[model samples]
Target: SQTIHQWPATLVQPVGSPLSLECTVEGTSNPNLYWYRQAAGRGLQLLFYSVGIGQISSEVPQNLSASRPQDRQFILSSKKLLLSDSGFYLCAWTGGAGAYGYTFGSGTRLTVV
Candidate 1:
């Protein structure tokens, strides 16, 4: 019965504006969390991940950052968004057992102008 929640389904922001996207999980504890971005007709790109509260790992160096403030909460933020940052952002999680696939959020589509 685990579920992931992401907000502001779609957003359009001016270049250099700040951004904040949040994801949280329920019915689970200490799940492996991740953030991903998908561009037009492209595959998902791993952004950040966390294994535990206050522990985060970045897959690529970019203008964005992520944090795990709680065991089941992850946040992605940017101080100044770039046009290149526009994409579909998703939050996902694994049971850490590797027995099944990941559970993904509805995703946030960001457009920078």
Candidate 2:
């Protein structure tokens, strides 16, 4: 059996609080990882994507950062939470690039108070 790990399924953070969400894709190497944000009744927004270690691309100019420390690990962190940052966070992994190969995590629902 294969195992995957994702953290902080739900979070209630203050306006000025710090945030850290983690996702890992085990049993795979050099996988493409993506972080997306979706607002209530709104379309999805791609936040970050990493194709390799130390390589990250930002889709939107928002208050968010993503890091790929290892070949199979990705982390999303915010220095300080903002009310606008409240949304549903999704992490997905794929074998390089392909719409059919994408596998998403459980996702995190963050609400900034």
Candidate 3:
């Protein structure tokens, strides 16, 4: 019974401000974690992934970064948020590539004003 948690459900921030989003998992270990961003009317885009602690892979080059400090803790951070950064952010996990579909947490919708 693995589960993921993310918050705050919605966010509004001015452009050029900093951003920090957190995700955590329970009931699983060594699971692959992923960070995805879905823009308005766009498909899910991978932002970062981690196979283990301190090992992260970046899929997109944007104004954001990701970190995995613990076994089930992943964080997304941005120094200066951009207008284009406003979107739905999702945190997901899976056993592996050939495993079952991903389990996504309750996403965070960010609006950069």
Candidate 4:
């Protein structure tokens, strides 16, 4: 069984704070990992994704960065946060595109104050 884990189910951070969110896949290897943000009632926006260790791709120009330090570990970080960064952050994984789709984490609700 494969599972994705994300932390701090909820967060309240001040503007300009540093942010770090981690996602890890257990029981899977070299899975495609993604970081997505969803505005209130809006569709998910792809922020970053990784296909392998040390490989990351950004889907949009933003204030966030993603890194894959290990085959099944992905990290999303920002040196400084923005008020617009508030949203629902979700970590997801898939063995392959158009396959089983995505297995998402419980998600983190971030509120920038």
RMSD of every prediction = 0.8, 1.3, 0.8, 0.8
Clashes per model (N, Cα, C within 3 A): 0, 0, 0, 0
Window of ten residues with lowest summed lDDT in model 3? 93-102
**Model 4 clashing residue pairs (backbone):** none
Worst 10 residues of 4 by lDDT: 94-103
Q: Please list the C-alpha lDDT of all candidates, in the order they appear.
A: 0.95, 0.89, 0.95, 0.92
Q: In model 1, what is the error at residue 13, expressed in angstroms?
A: 0.9
Return the lDDT, model 3, position 99.
Answer: 72
| Candidate 1 displacement at residue 113 in angstroms | 0.7
lDDT of 1 by residue, 1-113 (tens): 99899987999999999999999999998899999999999999999989899999999999999999999999999999999999999999998675678999999999999
List candidate 4 segments past 4 Å from native. none
**lDDT winner, 3 or 4:** 3
RMSD of 4: 0.8
